[model samples]
Target: MSEFAFEVALCALLERERDEIIARQLGASVHGRRIMDIVCVEPGPDFAKRVAITPHEIPDAAIESRAGVGQARYYRNCFDMHPDRARSVAERAIEIGFFERVRQGSRLYVRQTARYPDEWFGKLVGIENKPDLAVPGDLELQLRKDVSLGVFDEVILATESYVTGAHLNRIPDEVGVWRFRPETGGLEVVREPTALDPAASGVDIVDEYAGRTDMRVATAAEKARLRRRMAERAYGKGWRSFDLPPCVHGAAKTVSGADGIPYCEWKESVVNPAEECGPACPGYEPADPPEIDIEAVRDRRTPWVANPKGPRTQSGLDRFL
Candidate 1:
């Protein structure tokens, strides 16, 4: 099976089996360029509070700002970033219902609609999908980076290849192994992962040369901030981030009870629309894309809310102010 198909199938299976928030293709690095294939966010004490605030991501800058729910503060005073950037973040926060703004004597003031929940998310699990382990591409180095950074509470490798003694020796001991068959929707945990300490400082591998490597120490505070960002992003951006192709053959296929998996009739299997679909293919025919309400599907299959009443209950005048 194609790696894209395998990823979608696994995500669907995980979403059906697990109660946590599931997102795919998220930035998991604090300072480096590492994109995790799948991220599972376990709910913390105030997960519901977060879900109530907004269906979209709350800007990190707004969360870090000094805005309070009790009183409105001058917008400029709340953020430490550049004036233009701060304004942009505040505007996004307001748009997302995380912040409510009012104008006072030509000065804009903003306050949190509700308090930002510090305990909105619990442990984060990162998964790396490599369907064909025989052609592993920097798999070891990637896993090593994840283990050293300790950004995720647990790191897991999911593959369809048959594991041998040689493969286990190359993989990090702390990283768990899972053999998944996409066609059968079968998953077997070959090894269990050891929990990593996300609260502690970690090493960020910056660059590597022939014999030497450059690294930076990421403070616990930085990791904490990254974790919050990850949680917010995962909550907002689920795995079904793709659109069905605008081709006659494009169709939505259900996998493990989760709808909206992009399937191609010409190929007779799940396909990545972005890469595989276009007029360049001989089987392609112009047509309107299938009408699939992906967000509704997500809402039906998961705890995520597609649309919720904003936390702000102020009069209509206040909303425009």
Candidate 2:
């Protein structure tokens, strides 16, 4: 399979526990409304026909007049709903990137929140009525019409590593990628940089479980992660969720298995190692060995000839000189 071009981002999961916290307070689910396998399709042209995942809305009361899963949790942990809670779940949500806390004039402010940012976060393109905001939380989340959950759609691969190894070919302009998290959870945004960039932010998780991006590396590191992930697959247990190296062989150093035989060893000797390859391979980034000397090379009248014993000139008497 070839790499499919698609924009990518993330939407935080809503508290969708299937139980009630208090008899009076309850919680809501991000995917609560639809029981089907729904792939949230975004309204295009950047605006219009945007849909909201209605389940994120704050319900009037628990399903049975008690705090449902969401209501109880938020209230118990100090949700804005119950100003008398022991802790504030809303504050924690903002701290953990669940929602944003913006100031509204006076005490009456609008909520710019979403259960899953992708579920209900977007431009108000085609929304007919203003949804009621009853979920009492520090940050009030609102609904939108133009945008949708970011899945395999808004991703970008800066590094060619994914393209080189996989049978997948990524078509251009497929997914919209973002370098930073969105303010309103408008699109799916991850904390980690795409594997195409050498930046090492662990937040580089896939937009979803099935989605994946490369772990950007300096060839050797990439090889390492590839081997680790591949080992899981070779064992017939783990699914191949991450990207692999390119078509080049021998460029990767295959670690030996306990069987006394190496898997995929031929790929290394057959492929060319990149210049940035590390100790696992011959290539490496230039690191100053030591502040030995500009004067050492300049002062020496003759280059120290290489001897198996040590680096020195051939002349026995000249050694001191």
Top model by lDDT, which number? 1
Q: What is the lDDT, from 0 to 100, of the residue 318 in candidate 1?
A: 28
Q: Each candidate's TM vs. the true structure?
A: 0.95, 0.16
lDDT of 1 by residue, 45-87 (tens): 7676777788898888899999999889999999997999989
Residues 35-106, candidate 2, lDDT per residue (tens digit)?
111122222221110112111112212111222223223233222345532224444433433334444443
Top candidate when judged by TM-score against the true structure: 1
lDDT of 1: 0.88
Supply the TM-score for candidate 2: 0.16
Q: Residue 23 of candidate 1: its Cα lDDT?
A: 95
lDDT, candidate 1, at 75? 90
Estimate candidate 2's alpha-carbon lDDT, on a 0 to 1 scale: 0.21
Worst 10 residues of 2 by lDDT: 18-27
Score each candidate by Cα lDDT. 0.88, 0.21
